[model samples]
Target chain A: MSRRFASLGLALALVCGLAPARESAAADTYAVDAVHSAVVFRIKHMNTSHSWGRFNELTGTFALDEASPSQSHFEFQVKTGSVDTGNAKRDQHIKGPDFFNATQFPTISFKSTSVAKGADGYDVTGELTLHGVTKPITVKIVPVGVGKGPTGGSIAGIDTSFTLKRSDFGMNKMVGPVGDDVWVNVSIEGGKK
Target chain B: MSPAGMMLATLVLPFVSAGLVMIGAGWLGRRLGIERADHAAAALAVGVGYVVGHAAIASPTFPPLDVTDRIPWLAGLAAILGILESIWPGPSWTLWENRLLLTALVLSALLGPLFAESSENRPSTVCLVVYGLIALASWTNLSGLADRLSGARLGVPLLTVGFGIAIALVVSGSLALGQLSAVLAAAVAAMVLLKLGSPMLLGTVPVMVATFGALLLNSFIYAALPASAAVALVSAPAAFWVSRLGRMERLATWKVVLVTEFATLIPVGIALALAFSASPGYAE
Candidate 1:
């Protein structure tokens, strides 16, 4: 009877010791601050000139799962109406149904599916939902660093990039000869959750 | 074009088509007249078409060839060369020599349509094709120069131990080999395709043949079996082989170009097929 009790106590101690390690494996989550991140694209103008532009007003949540990336999740909402170029007329035209159709599909989103660590970074695979279509996208992410924020909070910074076919998500209409690819640049800052 | 597409266009199709045309163009070129133009016109037309096509594939405009101006004239000039290669059997160049030159020209032409940035699909696809052609071209030149420098030294082995390691890894099922093997094969082919100064078809044939043979061998290894292996399998050996071949080649101007007319024909055919297939109302 004494040996049984002692064995049970030792098992309990082992379980208690492992709890913190498992907890540490959980990656922190962060809320993306739109003002800090930039979403931009470039297209060839008339097969001669290259033109660039950006979209403003984005709100999103980034969940980092250090333990199991498959368990991680990312949800982002970009206001379709925020499409902007230096030219107001072009911006307006882009927002119309022929382009972004902001009124029709009001949000562009991404959700994480998996993450695999690599030599200097990690490969993050996810589904990017845009223009009412969802497609698998993978991006290579390098952790810039992690530290405390001005608000007495912890934060993590990461940079990632991937390419998507605009036409795949039904963004086929164009004002001119703009090609179908739209490259995405992701700069994310996550806070401990 | 997305990066994925660029991967396909620049890295994949160029080598595939180059291999295919190299194998078949002798009879086809006879029908098409691929060798007739004076060397200068032939070179300029092929070079310009190749460069322009490359520029278009890389840019975002999806630029269509200029229908009204210089493009047609260039096309006509290229067409004349095409006719010469196909029908004219009267030249000093043997069947093997003709085949080699045609393959190189086709690859060069195709490179124009395939070169693109890695992130965009259209460009990536084009880039993959260009990469494949370049790989084949690189190998051809490497071997040609090596042979000339050695005066037909037969002891050099183009396939290194790395090839066996890759084959073993691939067969054992560790990494994805399809796309990677294709790319590695191109690399091997490129190492041999390095040029010598002479324009003589006979001078270029051996290197082109050996480079292309290596690419085919790599492709055959993968196509014959659906295996999982990291790209390093083929790439590691290709790197080793390229170094060995380069070391053997004597000092000479590296101006050798693997770009050619047949290269244009294949991608244009593929692109046209894609465009037609993607036409409105076509099933996804």
Candidate 2:
């Protein structure tokens, strides 16, 4: 009877010790607030003016630990096939191999590597993969206004931007007239993962 | 001076240099018994086609008024290729020659319809120039094959890999037309240096031509825009002289030229894109 009681106590203690990890994981859940979040980009159309584009369906999760923010991580997956450039014909062309090669590479994604606090915001370094090519990029994420949702959910807002070279991953089809530097603007709204 | 003079300086000189080189290549090919001078001449002609295509429809002012010029540079390149074939028996180079003709034809077919779509003209013609230049690079590769001349001395595999890297940049929107060309020129020039045992004098020209050519072209496009007029004016001389120094330097100048131009243009591309995207009136 004593042995059974002691075993039960040990199991309970182990569970208690691991409780923090489980709870932290649960606390890290994040829901992208669609109304407040966006993924945007700008590229040179000719050498003249910038062409702008955005992806509408941005679905992601953010896992964070308040005590150890370095343990925080994010997973963002955007539908490459969902690119919007305000023109249907051009969108089709862009989705082709010359640009996104969406059929061949359907998802645009980012997985967080490290995060550091800065004066104005935080620098988030991650591996961003687009069109089957992946590269390491650092995005300076400026904390936009953060607040509570009407539903009493904790919401954190972040605005970040990064510059990437398209050729690093293999999308070197368009040049001469079209500017190459693809600038990405990300507005993220996260809740506990 | 006439508006033409400014345009000629900004847009015409590269073509002239390209043409002069074609003439020299033809003479040299014959002198050195280097097989096919015609192919080199044809390549030069395509270079002229690129300049003329870019310069054709502008106001000849400091900033030529538009962003997208669709002046049929491909047609000129095609015509020259056609002429070259007739002058020289090209069956020896069928594989590459055919691919060149086919690609030009395809581009023309794809873009040809747009010519008649509207005469309203895009404010900046950078996109079209980019497409044309990519085609030019394709042509260069094709011509290189036809003449049995490996211009960069990099094996076909490395060249393919470099092109693949470039394509990734294009798709990801990290390196646009200008940056792509600059990088490619740099890569090609570096290859020449490496292959030639880093010969200081002979190796410098291609690097100068490729790097400065890209920067000058980009700066000229920027200058042609009235909105970017100030920035272009300040940077144009810098582009010109940097290129001039690249040209005049006898050392293996590829590293300096390529790195400087690339570093300078990359940030410019990011800033220009962000600035334009942030503007209110522009359509996103």
Candidate 3:
């Protein structure tokens, strides 16, 4: 009975000793709040006007290490079929092969390769896979702030904007009339997970 | 320019180039020291050049490698095969060599689309087997037709035109596909002019490669039209066999052309109707 008590005490001590170490190594993880977050893009239309479109479905997670920002990681996926440009006909057309070929590719995704501190916020370099093509892209992520949510959960807000040429992702169908460069803006609200 | 204007220009560029090449085929053929300038080769080169140039101009930065891009690469492979066939001539090729080449070209064209489709849902092995069989059968049928009508001055050109028109109609649902269809039409139009007088056999290899490549792109990559519709359009050339009917035995050349066109139009019309019906309002 004494030996059993001593073993139990040693196990308890070991657990207590590892808790702080684990806490120190753990980075805060946030689950993207889809209801609040949005991925939107704008492209030139007929070289005359800018047409705005947005993806309805977005899911991602990010690990933030405030002490060492470079250790932060980010991942995101946008459903190509969920593209909405207001007009249903146009949305369907974009979902077709002429633009997205969503059936074949399904989704456009990004996975961060590296993160670095920047003057404004953070420069996150990642591989963006779109239209079945994967290319390394960097986006400037500006942290909005971290605060307590109405639900008493920790919430973090981030804003990122980047310009990507559609042709870079093999969407080289209409060029002159519809401009090639596409401006993407991401506003994300993440809850602590 | 407007989108329509851009599309028209893209479509016309290949036709103009083909016409120029056709007009100069004799001189080019003589200059190259070949029996003929090889109209099919010219078509392949011009078609591929236009596609590449269009891609380059549209997006100076080429897209990263992907399965859909294989269509252009396969077209390039077909062009290389066409050049070799022109230089070496098909009669000298061994039976096994022909078979191997045919298999390679067909497989390359089919695999890319198959892989693309497989990603949508898990395609069973049975489906793949059926697909492979269909591809082989289509390749055999089209290649045989091309071989039989090779030396016929008007037959191949008429069939090519029918194919181009059919593909254009089928792909009209999608602007990108329509552009590709236009490129194909321009290539064949050029081939028709180039091979007008000399009439060297346009080898079956390029036809199989380009036709199958385009069909795969239409069915798998873009899926703008139903697969059955694309099949009907591509296989419409088999209607060339209609010329072998008893009524066509003693018919005049113009009558033959008219009859063949009529027969080919049946399938082409059906394909067009199906494609347009599939897309309620695909107007760009």
Candidate 4:
């Protein structure tokens, strides 16, 4: 009778949105620590060496679970005008109409729609909006590690790198000289709530 | 094309159109016996140069997603409207009315986007509206100068102002805006090459004026251009009135021109100086 009663309660708990004690109940929410995280990009200059740049301002949040990859999600918003390339003149030109067009399209954003476990880590499919154009992009994100934060909160490190065609986003200017392929590298440190 | 290539094209294409198309159309109009076709040709040449020059830098997107993408298409519209205004046999008031409507449309296209977005960095709506009114008034007076003054008298001031504004924008941290401004000046130079000291105005006046207002507004709102510098730049062309001194009977044309050039340089100098001092690009 005791074993039968335990099974009935277990069934009720499952129906009431409770998970088994051994399994994760929900994904942990992590607010991106902008100070420690960074998004950087490099494009070939004249098809020779790479030219590097980074967005100075970024804000985002993510929910992640290794056990339940389906529940994992990431979203990021980057201020387009904050593009810093070290050279002031080229920075202005890049921010102008020919490139990002920062005034009209002030923000570049990404919101993940799906996440799936891959061989290395998780393959996240999301919409990346850039230069006033939005397109679906899939990126491979690896779980670097996890530790305690300065405030004694849980923390996680994720790393990702992807290549995208500039022409695909309607940025076709100087295609030959500036090259079409841009490689983006992101290292994110998120603090768990 | 590379940036250097784009800059070269910006300066050269307009000169080519103005030099070749303007004279060719005027001569052909006389040969084919089409009246006022020369006036229409002037507008067409400048518009063609402007659109082509801008496209050479950045090909516009389909449906124009970005504000700058509309530049080539807007230049096309201004050319068409200018040709109609030039050829219309309607009353003077009707021509002015058509021009007024065109001004409103152009202002909305350029300034409307800036005003729609609520951002602290952007100029206030009232200031932008007043700036548009100032640009409109500036164009009207410059067009009047086109009727009384022609040749270097008209072209030099425009060229100087264009180069000045271009320099100011570049210093204020927008190479693209500076290049765009220089492109307009190049088109005007082309028109002046064809019709020096002729005492007539063409549709190019409205075309240049409309585009100039839009570019200046973008420079201030989008780039690091300061508001005070924009005002001084907008009012820079008004100094063309000083060229009226050439109309004096006893004044040597060279003496009158020298003084006119210096007078036109004042506002541009002030604007450039202000841009250098106040621009966030420089301050940072």
> What TM-scores do the predictions have?
0.39, 0.41, 0.79, 0.88
What is the lDDT of every predicted structure here?
0.45, 0.49, 0.66, 0.78
What TM-score does candidate 3 reach?
Answer: 0.79
Candidate 1 residue A178 Cα shift, in angstroms, is 2.0
Give Cα distance to truth, residue B200, candidate 1, Å.
75
> Alpha carbon lDDT of residue A31, candidate 2?
76
* Clash tally, candidates in order: 80, 49, 0, 2
Candidate 3 lDDT over B32-118, as tens digits, reads: 787535644564555454455345323323332434444555556666566556666667445336545645565544454446543
Stronger candidate by lDDT (2 vs 3): 3
Candidate 2 at B9: error in angstroms? 9.1
Model 4, span B65-134: residue lDDT tens: 7766666677778788777777664687876776677777776676555565533355577875786577
Predictions' DockQ, in order:
0.01, 0.02, 0.37, 0.37
Which regions of candidate 4 are displaced past 4 Å? A1-14, A17-23, A44-49, A87-93, A172-180, B1-7, B27-34, B115-123, B246-252, B278-284
Cα misplacement distance, residue B61 of candidate 4 (Å):
2.2
lDDT of 1 by residue, A81-140 (tens): 787777755664455433564544567887778777767777778888786577888877
> Can you write out model 2's per-residue Cα lDDT over B99-195, one digit (the tens) per residue?
4454545444334433543323232367656645654553454334323323332222223333333332332322233333323333333333333
Candidate 4, residue A162: how far the Cα is off, in Å:
1.7
Off by over 4 Å in 2: A1-12, A24-26, A40-55, A78-108, A117-122, A129-135, A140-156, A161-185, A191-193, B1-14, B32-40, B43-284
- At residue A59, what lDDT does model 3 achieve? 95
lDDT tens digits by residue: candidate 2, A112-137: 99977667766678999875567888
TM-score of chain B of 4: 0.89
Tens-digit per-residue lDDT, A30-118, candidate 3:
88998899999999987789999999899999876767888899999998889988876677578776678777678899999999888
Tell the DockQ for candidate 2.
Answer: 0.02
1 or 2: which has the higher TM-score?
A: 2
